[model samples]
Target: MRGVLVFDVDGVLVDVTDSYRETIIRTIEHFTSRRVTRDDIQQIKNLGGYNDDWALCKKVIQDFGCHPKYQEIVDHFQRIFLGENSDGLILRERWVARDGLFEQLAKDWRLAIFTGRTRSETRLTLDRFGAQAVFDPLIGNDDVENLKPAPDGLLKICATFPGVEVVYVGDTVDDAKSAGRAGVGFIGVAPQQDSRRAELVELFRQEGARAVVDNINELEQVLK
Candidate 1:
């Protein structure tokens, strides 16, 4: 049986450094009037359990001595990310999939998504890339009771495939923990250009990832 190749959307299949990451920075500044850096965001990501960006943003705002309702943060984040007129930071995202990458991977492994993005967010990118057909059982945040670092999403995919070997490609420490808890193999993505590359690589190694690659384009060789 072909193994399942599961992917985390942000930083794995799509580069969200400018979109989602930027949204977090913008959200924090909007609430706190303090311009935060990606390092601020990465610090929280490194600590894990802040998979929900809204939750992370709220924590950042609180650190700056502002207390906004969770829904307030969520609303502001969506405005910046999705935009009021459909022209938001989300459009700034760059597609990471190279030509024929997913097509080739699909030949040997079934592809699926288990991401922090809502189904609509995932679909927007998939539709832009014309990649809706490439992934099956696209598990989004709303699909599960718990998000990453909880094995819920990975277990859901495994249940779908039924006994197939499974591998998860993800970018953060939470992603590794999610895979580990689900008893699935994991490949960590830490691009060479990322300022936090060294830190992420060490964390993935500490988590016992099967392998760590810079990006999904390199995933083919590791899967071999």
Candidate 2:
């Protein structure tokens, strides 16, 4: 059977260390007027359950004793994130995979995206990278009622391309959990940065990841 490969945008295909991660930290600081570290944001991310960064920002704001209305938080977040020109917050995404990797994969398998980003934001990034045509049935947080750790997005991909063996490639525990819930195979991509790779491998292994690769370049071999 031809395989179906579903990808998570941030941290899987695109490196978010300087983009989404920075936005999360900056958004929280803007509201609370208090500094928050990337590690702090990562802690919440590691805990899973938070599939939306806006919601995550709100939770952090509440934890810091600031209860801004949801709309207020969202507005502030978009201002910092979308910036003056509506270009982007931290436009520093680098591809995790090697060049031509996705194109090569497309030759044999159906490729799609399932991400926590809203459709507009996801489209912006994809367009920025000139990768708008790479995926089919692209799914974002807006496409479903529930996010990661819930099978809604992955289930949608499966239904769209039924009867194929679906494999999800992602970077977070939530990604693994969602794939597990959807009853699909999962491959975990740990950060390529030295010790973090080892740490994430262990984490994904604990989550029952079928295989954990330290970098996206390793995926070609693993899929073989």
Candidate 3:
């Protein structure tokens, strides 16, 4: 039986928090005319949930009555969220894999990416990182109306690669829930000892995650 390992791109594989934070701040400043602090961004994001990413962002910035349409917001974020310059507005890290990753992972499973990104952006990032070779059949923002914390994308992936054991690895509670919602096993590949790490592990447990490890280094023990 073929086994499949589906992954989330942003946090799990690529550390883009800085870029994302700046993009949100810029988007808000551009449309709302109100400056947002980091705390404010977290509050809005935590409350809005995954499906509301774009819509909530627009709503927060729609105060000037000069708000652009959804596609325009999409265009704006895409243009700003990608790059490798440290002096850049956002702190987006390169999409390099964690150490000893492919050698350990690719041997046992067919890999794929399900990201909350437009196809063009996702493709570009994947291409830039040289990770496209590892992930086949990429699914992005264009593929579905709902993303993580919802299961449609992963289920779609399972359907495409029929009969494979599905293991969806990610770095957040939303990912764990999405995997569970899709009836697949979830693995949390956390990289740091953030305060939220334990909470995320517990959350995944609550959501029925098969394993929650600090990194993919623990995967072999769990998968075996």
Candidate 4:
């Protein structure tokens, strides 16, 4: 009676590309007077890095403590990192919620989000993108101690809407793992050139992913 469609926000929904890393690099530079290269940021993302962005900044602090106003620098970086997004970040023609993505899915499933982003950031992205209206319930990183690759978010979604066919659609291997951990159907949305996606696809299948789509548009056929 309550089927669900859960999504990952960053690449699947937001199309962040390199902005997250770029902003974070800038943030680290602003704080500790050290600027991490794009390659380093990609490494961090690949390594499943977490533990308060400040910790990442701390790593740089050891090298360049030259910044006079470290606290101010940190504050500036925070503002930029978790800072307000531009209109394009929220709603651009190219990234308009996958062009009838939720619309088709919502017809059959109770749509929702299970992203690594904070609820505040999630709301900002969704509302600005005009996507909030499509989903009845939303699950954000703020709701759980752990994120993707952790079952908390998926399990929470399953618990919220019990006795329903659950489908977790996400762009990362972590998404597939989280869905498997939650004992639900995992649909891997493996966007092309998404960095290790082929290996991730194999991992997804090994982890019990039901399907893997190249894009949200492909989800229609894959879900069927």
Q: Lowest-lDDT window of 10 residues in candidate 2?
A: 191-200
Model 2 lDDT tens row, 118-167 = 88888888888888998888999889998778999999988987788999
Q: What is the C-alpha lDDT profile of model 3 across 1-224, one tens digit per residue?
A: 35888878766776655666667778777766777765565445443254335665677767546658889886666556543443343345555466668767888888888877777767766776776677887888789887667898998998997777999988766777788888999887755645445555666688788877776656778888
- What root-mean-square deviation over C-alphas does model 2 reach? 1.8
Q: After superposing candidate 4, which stretches have Cα over 4 Å from the reference? A: 28-44, 49-77, 82-96
Candidate 2: which stretches are off by over 4 Å?
194-199
Q: Is candidate 1 or candidate 4 better by lDDT?
A: 1
What lDDT score is found at residue 57 in candidate 3? 69
lDDT of 3 at 156: 91
- Assess candidate 1 and give its lDDT: 0.91
Quote the positional error of residue 194 for candidate 2 in Å: 7.5
Q: Estimate each model's TM-score.
A: 0.98, 0.92, 0.78, 0.76
Sequence-dependent TM-score of model 3 = 0.78
Q: State how far residue 9 of model 4 sits from its true place (Å).
A: 0.9
**lDDT (10s digit) by residue, model 4, range 137-163:** 788878998866788988887888878
Error of 2 at 113 (Å): 0.6
**Model 4, global lDDT:** 0.68
